[model samples]
Target chain A: MRFSVLILGNSSATPMYERHPTSQVVNHNEQLYLIDCGEGTQMQLTRYGIKSNRINHIFISHLHGDHYLGLVGLISSMHLMGRKTDLHLYGPAPLEEILALNFKYSETELRYNLIFHPTNPTETAVLFESKLLRVESFPLRHRIACTGFRFQEGERPAKLDIDKVAKLQIPPALINGIKWGLDFTDKDGKVHPSSELTTPAPLPRSYAYCSDTVRIPDYLPSIHRANLLYHESTFLHEMKDRAVETFHTTSFEAGEIAKEAEVGHLLLGHYSARYKTKELTLLLDEARSAFPHTDLSVEGKWYEVE
Target chain B: MRFSVLILGNSSATPMYERHPTSQVVNHNEQLYLIDCGEGTQMQLTRYGIKSNRINHIFISHLHGDHYLGLVGLISSMHLMGRKTDLHLYGPAPLEEILALNFKYSETELRYNLIFHPTNPTETAVLFESKLLRVESFPLRHRIACTGFRFQEGERPAKLDIDKVAKLQIPPALINGIKWGLDFTDKDGKVHPSSELTTPAPLPRSYAYCSDTVRIPDYLPSIHRANLLYHESTFLHEMKDRAVETFHTTSFEAGEIAKEAEVGHLLLGHYSARYKTKELTLLLDEARSAFPHTDLSVEGKWYEVE
Candidate 1:
């Protein structure tokens, strides 16, 4: 299983020459999950060559334009391309109303089933669960009602020790059972312990996405120790006061949250348009001072979590 | 006056790799008018180096997502930029409902006044008028209530014949009156006819935008003899059946309409994504067979009306 995040856009409020707004795609196994689609997200997806048809679920943090503007276009395109699979959309209630009105006036009847799941951003709840992963949303502090999502991979099966299996002349079925953490029982009533024949599975990996929000310490418990954390850093340290006033976070503040939460790696993004490409280094340095694993999020870049 | 149509997006239904949905910026003098705002219009504006602050009015053809998905994002960006100028939005009534719900959920108080002018696409009405131009909407045949707009320049002043003015030793004030189509009178009551002093102004230019509509002969009366006509050509001649089935027009049909309307120049655009850039020549050729003055609408190309 591969758990990773592809940054589609990383600017805030308005798209600039240097950066875009908020959009990310989380790839887990064979499925793709979209988070907070901003303007030009479909273009970003095209630029990265990510198959948008593989995306079955979309999680929108809020009704803010920068966070969800690309959604209707993406949905409309899917229908035009003859997509028949059901699309699950999770967001605030108002988003559905907006989408419905447009569809109503356009006389557009979608070919696919659109499922809407409205959530309260102040509550912590499991949004959906699949065979390979589970998704949950928690509260975040913002000017509007916004939520953050946590994606956790399912537990993995044990790995069989090939050398031991060959030395013991074990059958393939017995090795499979051992890998499933089951002891092998022979016809002669002899039993082989699973632990002795197989190695333990690796720890399950998780990723948390915090977008368009101020630094909220209360979300630490839900997102703590995530393998990877993507947080909005809309401004540099010098704009800390502006960040607070606008209900956003600085890169340094994002790094502090990641360090306090004990996340494995931190990806800082949602940069303000005022900073050019050259000034990104200043933000990276400021963040690295608090979290060494912090890295600036660039569009089209993918981060892998092991 | 500069009468240029900046192609913000030309893709239809769903956004594709090289094409965007319907959105164009019509630049006339110092004012910028948005014709149809599709998703990612703001990014397109930024990419094309258009100043978003210059836009004072937005005219939506219908309630299709591809036509107006970018409205909320653009409005939000204006608020974020602290824009104090009032914006006039003309679209179907449902658009106001959608925007209202979005503003409520996001808890956004726009710093500028967003005047919503609900349009009855089924009727022909004068929508807006300014010192430089007048805009009126005419009925268009589509699946929904859609309308096309005609932007006509205000009446031009008569041009002064410099040699005649110099020979007659006419005062500047008298020249101004002559240009205004009034006869000049001297202190001794000697009158000079305006026609003898000045020549007629060049015909006032006009541009008609027929976006996302099927073949409609009824609109010819309203847009006849326009200086330039921009019509949506979503498909080619071979896809005539498909165009009719989807309430869209092919390049051939667009050219036919332009020929019947006796438009000075026909501009064909809104290409389907399935066709490559190389295939655009085929579209242009089809249109030229019927209307020799037809031209393909290319992005970043500017058209000036003299």
Candidate 2:
């Protein structure tokens, strides 16, 4: 299975000439999940050739314009394209009301079903579950009620050791049982352990997205051991005071969080427009000093995780 | 007075690779007014060097995502920039509710007062008045309750022919009276007719913005005599069936309306993404067949009214 993330936008608060606001697309297998669609997200999707109609689920972190302004436009475009598949939207309580009012005034009846699942941003709980992945939301310390998400792949069955099974003359039915972590018995009633015939599968991969938050150490437990982690770094270490005042995190602070969480890799984005493109390298260097796997999130770039 | 219109975005529903959605900035003297901000409008404003703080009023024609999606982001950016001026917003009733919900959830204490003026899309009435301009909304036939705005500049005082006034030995006070279209009377009580001394001031310049609407003949009376008119031409004449079904107008239809209204200049925009830049000239030609003064609206291009 292919698990990756495509960065669509990364600028914070205000959009500048070279950077855009917050938006990212998470690709798992053949499905795409959109997260925090800011203004011009649809344009980014078009530029990247991502079929927006294939995106069945969207997760909005909060009501901030930079986090969700593009949602209405994205939804409207889907309707205009004659989409008929039901779409699931998860966000704060008031988001649905806002969308409903807009549709009411425009007299727009979407051909697709827009199922809204309002989440409580103050608590940690499971937000979505499917056969391939399970998503959970954890609280974040911000000016508003904000939450971060953790996506982990479902458990996989054990793999059969073909050489060992063949040498042992394991039947096809017994091979299936061994893959399920069950022991096989011989005709003479001799017990054969499943571990002897099969090998354990690799650990399920996971990713965590944390944005628009200050230092929230409490979330480490839920986000720890992620294969890939994306966090907002709105400022550099020199502007830590401003970052705290604005409920954002500095690059150094984001690196510290990734190090403490022991995530495999850290991708920092949501840069303040004040910094030029060259300054991003300096910020990434500061982050990498603490978390060696740190990298800057660039728009239109994709990061793949096994 | 300098009267000009800056095209910020001209694409239809979905913003394409080379075209952006609907947005325009009208500059009258030193004041600026924003009309129909689509997604990514803030970035467009930055690209064109439009100071966001200078826009004190915003008018939205409808609740379509392409028409008003940038409003919340613009408002948020204003707050981020520490603006203290009040902003007047005129739009459909549901917009107020959406803005309120966003503000409520974001926990944003706006630095400026957002004065929302709810507009009834079904009625044609004066929506706002300022020292320099009077704005009125006229009904338009669309898929929803949409309206177009007519911006009429307040009448200017007549300019005195300085050479003529000086040659006639008119007093300063008498010159002011003549500028106000009053007859000048000499000390001997001899009456002077106003027409003999001064010509009528140029008719008040006006601009009308009709976006995402069908060619409704009834609107000609409300928009007649406008110095400049911007109308949506979402398709070509061959797509008339699609235009009517979607409540949009073609280039030919847009020109027909402008010709019927006798507008000075017709600006055609809101192009369908199906056409490329090379096709724009052909579309303009089609429009000019009916209205000789028709022009295509291009992004970052400004049109000045004499």
Which candidate comes out best when scored by DockQ? 1
- lDDT at position B288, candidate 2: 94
lDDT of 2 at B76: 92
Per residue, candidate 2 scores C-alpha lDDT tens digits across B1-306 of 788999999999978875898999999887899998899898899999999999999999988888998988999999998899999999888788878877877777898899999887777889888767898998888888788999899886677677777767788867766877898776688877766677777778999999979887878888898999999999999999999999999999888999899899999999998888889887899899999999999999999754
> What fraction of the true interface does each of the listed models get right, in terms of native contacts kept?
0.95, 0.92
DockQ of each: 0.73, 0.64
- Candidate 2: where are CA atoms >4 Å away? A156-200, B157-203
TM-score of chain B of each: 0.92, 0.91
> CA lDDT, every prediction?
0.86, 0.88
User: Per-residue CA lDDT of candidate 1, range B1-306, in tens?
Assistant: 466677777766766776777888888886899998888788788888888889999999988888888888889988888899999999888889888877887788999999999987778888899867998989898878888998899977788989988877788867666887998776678888899888887678998999889997888888899988999888998998999998899999998999999998998888888788788889899999999998888766666543
**For model 2, how does the per-residue alpha-carbon lDDT over A1-306 read when each residue is reduced to its tens digit?**
779999999999888885888899999887899989998999989989998999999998877888898988899999988999999998888889888877876677899999999877878888889977988888888888788988899876688888878777878866766876889888789888888777886788999999879987888998899999999999999999999898999999999999999999999999998899987998898899899999999999999865
Candidate 2 reference-contact recovery: 0.92
Q: Residue B98: error of model 1 in Å?
A: 1.4
